[model samples]
Target: MFPTLDIQQPRPFDLVGSTILIAGNAAGFEGTLSITVSEGHDEVTGIASVGSLGLRQFQASIYIPDATAFQLTRIFVTIADDTGNENGPSVVIPVLFGPRILAGYSGWQPYTVRAGDTLTGIAQSQYGNADFQPIADANQNTLANPDLIFPGQILRIPRNDI
Candidate 1:
């Protein structure tokens, strides 16, 4: 039997656009590692070899096409140990679409950064402006650097998409 695997990247309902890194840990098995990111009719596999960390753990950084992020889609990750000698279940994550989910606020939306999040992404993607100058201004205090954003950090999205 395969030991339970823990996925550490692309949390559930995570938004996808640029190259997304898929990472996770699996122990007790040793040999090779294989990873796949699939959504609906499209799927991409690793052409390059997967690198092992220590023990049975491994990591792989993959790229999902930009077109996949244009609309709402379920992103799933699949891992195979030792070249499909055994495999783990795929869960819906790195999901596409939806600028941001309203966090029960009257005029603002709470957006937690997922795998790929940026001030420019919020502005252009959620608000439809690539410049995202308004977003930078809106989050002036926390958004000191427009180019860097990490998962789990909450950002208040202007209700007016400011």
Candidate 2:
């Protein structure tokens, strides 16, 4: 007898044309498992299966495509024995989409603070614009003095005009 299948992570993940990696584990009796993902009122988009050698654990990697911030509604994982008999339990995971910043602008560009690299200088070099305030804000005011940045402190460079 198996326990149940659970789909974890990516709860309400922002799906706007992005690939989301859904990962999780299972327990209690396993031979082979089939996984499926659907969007917007039970529309199946992807399916996959994993082979188990009498093991009680399973993991799956599912890629979702053409998803929007509003299309995803629910996710489900079904487990079955090698005889195609329904297993102990199946799991349904709810999905949500978060606010997307913008295309090609992840807002987490890394910057190594150099000997004298001011926020303004870094911004100018990275974004071709010398607007340091956005950088400071993005880094959570760690660049308050703009001239007090130390060596090896990573800063997130926000996309200009965003």
Candidate 3:
């Protein structure tokens, strides 16, 4: 492609960690290329260089900790040629970044229970609060006991800000 903005990673509903790989190529453009991911009040931006082959292959990263979880994050990619011809401000695609699992709605996020992870611990680690009842109630379909959870099981955590 002559001039293209392609997203090669973090596909829709794909489980991601604190650091999600934001990769793509903006070939045929020079100058600077910036890839930005923003959700709510949190955003991560990165820059990559154009190679000698007249291709700008970017393999940058965006860290969202627990901020962008359960939200429709906007992917903004832009490129400018050496002569200052700008290609974007273009919104490439919208992707969901979650902690461990992705729920169907933005009001909730999923977390894969790890070994020795309790609901209260999950709640504390995720929301910075140890109240696990909200998590247990939200994940009734997936978890039968708030006191016990197994690894590799997906548990939903409410996105309610406390």
Candidate 4:
């Protein structure tokens, strides 16, 4: 029987760090599973051991290249059968890739939006420049419009030192 996989953490559109923590349940397979992260341009794949007697939980960390980060708004994280088949059973989780999760800066600072706040303003205040692309890219899941953030909305300000 084909394996079944389900991603539980970092739900759709969540901002991910350099080292992503993927947790989920798997069934119908044993030995190992494949974890792939792709931006439709480039992809990284890793392997995780799975002992499938029945449904069981699994966790794996897949490292992403900085060049791949924020290049696209959304990336797909997939856990699939490792039989080298493109049509194998798998689960794809779409998430927003953050740029601030570079090698050195692997974390993000949370910023609460307030009235009259703009991406440029926030960028200038936080990054000392008017380049808001990074902020917009990191929070694309939350802020659809770069100029349309509302109060009480939380944004992830990537801790980019690189």
Candidate 5:
């Protein structure tokens, strides 16, 4: 019996907003699978259903109602079988939570860096007032040095309503 799960969306170390769209392939039972997003303390869980066939595509939109409860910015997304085995076949993805950076945010806009671009300049152009911390925080996986951004490098500009 095929018993493997693969997450194709929101790759590892990605930044997720309040609601995340998780899509992947499940090679196992047609029953439901457990999808959990946890930050070591608080967690959100959902169930995804696989196709009747042994191997099928599955998608689930999980909403983190209380985003403020998580202490750590990094969260884990795990998909496992319904057998409740502690060591069963599962896929765990570690991603940065975005709401912690930009309050009430659900997504980001992509900005391509130019030759004469700086985090401060980008912040002024994107967010006004030159507060680049939010931009840097939202793209921890991409930007290693806030001051050293290369041309053609894409950055995620977090959308903040609050």
Candidate 6:
């Protein structure tokens, strides 16, 4: 037999402007569990379950972004058996900064032609960088080609510096 656990978060979260509710479940055996969120080397937050759930289901939620942005590089969940054994898995959630205009720019900012930006040249004129690849990578599925952007498409411009 195999131990099982499942965790999920709603997608298309807003950056610097949304709240996320984290929830999940576990089976087989359990005494306590720990949940953690991180961004690269930064530890965002964590919580531990004090109650018991033997062969039953468990659920909890952690509020993301109380006052600031909920920038996350990874999310991890761990379950420990009563025998002092632990098992679980982690999930990575990509982070996008924001649509904030750079600085001192009156008109819309410039953007490069990423992999899927068919209108990349147009974006370049607006953003000034030809390396629009990050845009494509960020919105991989939606952007089909470098020159095939549809109307009302929102693209995440990579920050100039981390």
Top of the candidates by TM-score: 5
Model 4: per-residue Cα lDDT over 34-148, one tens digit each: 8888877778889987776767788878887664444565788888867667887888889866653333555678999999999999989988889888778777767778978
Worst-scoring 10-residue span by lDDT in model 5: 24-33
Query: RMSD, model 2, all Cα superposed?
Result: 8.8
Query: In model 5, which runs have C-alpha deviations exceeding 4 angstroms?
Result: 1-3, 28-30
Point out the higher-scoring one by TM-score: 1 or 6.
1
TM for every model, in the order presented, reads 0.45, 0.39, 0.43, 0.83, 0.88, 0.41
- For 1-162, candidate 5 gives per-residue lDDT tens digits of 555787897799888888877888886444778889998888889988886457678888888887796887788988887666677688889888888887787688999999999999999998777899889887787778898899999998888776
Give candidate 6 misplaced runs (Cα > 4 Å). Answer: 10-18, 27-31, 48-51, 55-57, 64-162
Q: What is the lDDT of candidate 6?
A: 0.42
Give the candidate order by descending lDDT: 5, 4, 3, 1, 2, 6
Candidate 2 minimal-lDDT segment of 10 residues = 94-103
Give the per-residue lDDT of model 6 (tens digit) for 1-162. 544444543233323222234445554234454544444444445453534543345555444443233233222222333334443333444433232222221222234434544545654754576655545544544666756776556655444332
Give lDDT per model, in order: 0.53, 0.48, 0.55, 0.76, 0.83, 0.42
Q: Which window of ten consecutive residues has the lowest lDDT sum in model 1? A: 97-106
Candidate 3 residue lDDT tens string, 2-90: 54555566554343445667566655345455655555554566655655365456675656546444354333322223333453434
TM-score of model 2 (CA atoms): 0.39
Error of 5 at 85 (Å): 0.8
After superposition, which runs of candidate 1 have C-alpha atoms over 4 Å from their true positions?
A: 1-4, 27-30, 47-57, 66-72, 85-94, 97-162
List the candidates ranked by TM-score, beginning with the highest. 5, 4, 1, 3, 6, 2
For model 4, what is the error of residue 138's alpha carbon versus the real structure, in angstroms, after optimal superposition? 0.9
What is residue 4's positional error in candidate 5, in angstroms? 1.3
